[model samples]
Target: MPKVLNITAARSRLTSLVQEAFLEQKRTLIGKHGVPMAALLPIREYEELLQDLEDLGDMLQAEQEYRRTGGKDFEDVVKKPKGRR
Candidate 1:
């Protein structure tokens, strides 16, 4: 489980919180009025999450393009007989 801290308390312990994220690879959830508002996590983890989102977006775009093109493979279309369009 991640460590949870209200904004006030987190402000007082910001240095240690940053160290925990960098060295320990731990997440800290910052909350306000009992609602989680943000997080502190390792930079590498954040980058990986961004990459995953990009990959998902690319896959969805490819699916949409395939559907728009009537699902014909590009290679199959190219290999058709010369007179057939």
Candidate 2:
């Protein structure tokens, strides 16, 4: 696991901590009472992580809906669709 910093120390060096995360491509775990509360990560990584989560949710919903509708996969349902390339 990456090294962790307490809330007080993190507050004092927020700028450097952010710089370290960016420059070293490492995460800074911040927390209180020895329990991690949050993480400092590169902006791109954070955005990608969020997008991955959204994609996972989308896949799960699609699976549930397809089961309810008794539908096959899109490829099996259609030979070709309009305005899709």
Candidate 3:
């Protein structure tokens, strides 16, 4: 689990927390009034997460397109040369 810090405490140790995230790949959670609100993680992880979300979106779009097109198999749409079985 990540270390949780309230807004006041996070202000004082922001530098150290950032260092931990960058150097050690540690995560930190920040909260206000005891309700968790934000997090700090390495930039690489954040970028990968964004990429994963984009890939998922692309998959969803492809699925919708397939359904709209009556879900024909790729091989069925491509023509084969005669005697090239």
TM-score of each: 0.79, 0.79, 0.82
lDDT values, one for every candidate: 0.91, 0.89, 0.91
Model 1 lDDT per residue over 1-85, tens place: 5656899999999999999889999899999876889999899899999999999999999999899988978798779798878
TM-score of 2: 0.79
> Which 10-residue window of candidate 2 scores lowest in summed lDDT?
73-82
Badly placed stretches (over 4 Å) of model 3 are 74-85
Model 1: residues with Cα > 4 Å off, grouped in runs: 1-3, 73-85
Top-TM-score structure, candidate number: 3
CA-only RMSD, every prediction: 4.8, 5.2, 2.6
lDDT (tens digit, per residue) of candidate 2 on 4-59: 78999999999998888788777889999878999999888999999999999999
Once fitted onto the true fold, the runs of candidate 2 whose alpha carbons sit more than 4 angstroms away are 74-85
